[model samples]
Target: MLTIAPAQAPSAADLWAVLTALRLLDDAAEDAAAARIEAARLTDETRWQAAGPRRLRQALTEYTVHLARLADELWFQRDQIARNALG
Candidate 1:
């Protein structure tokens, strides 16, 4: 929640503008990446104990890799878009 300063009261347009400027879209990718990594580590550790050492951890390993790759691709595209817009 953003509080409007007494000196700079926000208008209806300002509030609407904030709605359009959703920051979560940009953060989603990074959040997914971190979540994936943490999930994978925990899953792998759990599996290692479950039945001795295993080569694969279905729940976490695959998702972790996928998420990391997705984050890289998303950020890369975002940066490229910014550069293109500026140039």
Candidate 2:
């Protein structure tokens, strides 16, 4: 006969850590959005400038894109954790 063990409930400390992580991820996402907006504004303002500023703006934009993607993944993970916790 095969037997299955019941799932253990998360400890208070474990739940606290998860909640803290979720908050941090939310904050990071907000910061990423803000950075993207600032980058767009700066790029527009420096549109008539020389190549150096343009290159810097391009790099900033690329980094912000990566940050946004990371934030998205974190948020998805947060949601999955919350759902699993509830179950």
The top-ranked prediction according to TM-score is 2
Using all chains and alpha carbons, the TM-scores for the candidates as numbered come to: 0.55, 0.69
In candidate 2, clashing pairs total 0
lDDT of 1 by residue, 1-87 (tens): 997876655678865554434344358777877888797777757646454344446646777888888888767765665454333
Off by over 4 Å in 2: 1-6
Model 1, poorest ten-residue lDDT window? 16-25
Best by lDDT: 2
Provide the global lDDT of candidate 2 against the true structure.
0.75
* Tens digit of per-residue lDDT, candidate 2, span 29-84: 77876776776677667654678877887887787677667767777877887777
lDDT for 80 (candidate 2): 82
As for candidate 1, its clashing pairs are: none
